[model samples]
Target: MASQAESETGRPRYVPLCSSLLPLSRLTLIVHGPEHGHRIISPVEGCRRLYIRVNGIVQGVGFRPFVYRIAVRTGLAGFVRNLGDAGVEIEVEGPAGDVKSFLSALRDEAPPLAEIAELRVEERPPTGEKEFRILASRDGGEGGGTIPPDIATCDRCLADIDDPKSRYCGYWATSCTDCGPRFTVIGALP
Candidate 1:
């Protein structure tokens, strides 16, 4: 006899019965019941990989660096990069628990300038990667994503402008990761 259990997801699970309950007279016992689902459990425990695509005001606002820092701090291994004009793409691989935590932090701790519109996640096979890296921007897509509006100079940039020793000292075009020119700077070809 085997005890039945239900997981938190309301799925039925099985647990082994104590050996004392099984008498030597019974070499094998078979129990048949209604089919619940086709879920198969894996015996091995290890890390999982996830591919995440984030759409919206995720570019030109230090989103890539934000993700890279988060991944490294969380002990994850993978890469993050700009997806042309389609937002950003990230591939993260780590222990299942760590990966989940990283994902949560990614959403909660996004850069101040980032406005995430949509986030899609998909499972992927582990790539056995040991370190996380920031990749170069990729091009060629539908390119219909929203372009962020030009942001006013932030306090840091203002301070940099005021500091005599700063490279941007007294510079009128001072800018930084969180604040700078954006859509307004581009001009169409005639």
Candidate 2:
């Protein structure tokens, strides 16, 4: 008889009864309970794919390059692209741990100019992608992302400006993905 692995909802889910249980990652057992809540246990093993759509001031803020850098660093495969609604779409597939890491980095290390109003992630089957890539922009539903406003000079840019040897020294318009006028420079929505 299979033992029970209960979820947060107290639903009885079945699992092999073993004296020594497998690590949480290996257990396909109960991760969450109830459709209303998350799994109570279990972390899906093997390759996992996540389709992430980030909304807000994501366009014209160097958000795509930031996503690309994190995706590559985490050893994930997939693509990141800009949406017509001033949002970003990222699809990443790799080991579950790596994918999770990518997600965390994406949230915690977003560009300074990007004010993420909403981030939605959905799990999907692997697509067997060879490498991470940046795809072209796509049209999206109406009225989602916010128009990015001009950002103040960040510490990094300030440091560069203060550096006597730097090329951007004393250059007032100096800006990168992180800080500077964004919405002001845009001719139109991307």
Best by TM-score: 1
Candidates in order, TM-scores: namely: 0.73, 0.68
| lDDT tens digits, residue span 1-190, model 2 | 2455766878766544221223434555443335526443324335688899888888878888898999889888889998777778899987777788998898899876678888999988765566889998888655556777777888889988999999999988887766778678777754
Task: List candidate 2 stretches off by more than 4 Å.
Answer: 1-45, 162-164
Error of 1 at 187 (Å): 4.8
Clashes of 2: 6
How high is the lDDT of residue 66 in model 1?
Answer: 93
**Displacement of the residue 96 alpha carbon in candidate 2, Å:** 1.3
Q: How far off is residue 121 in model 2, in Å? A: 1.8
Q: For candidate 1, which ten residues in a row score worst on lDDT? A: 36-45
Instruction: State in Å the error of residue 67, model 2.
Output: 1.4
Which candidate number maximizes lDDT? Answer: 1
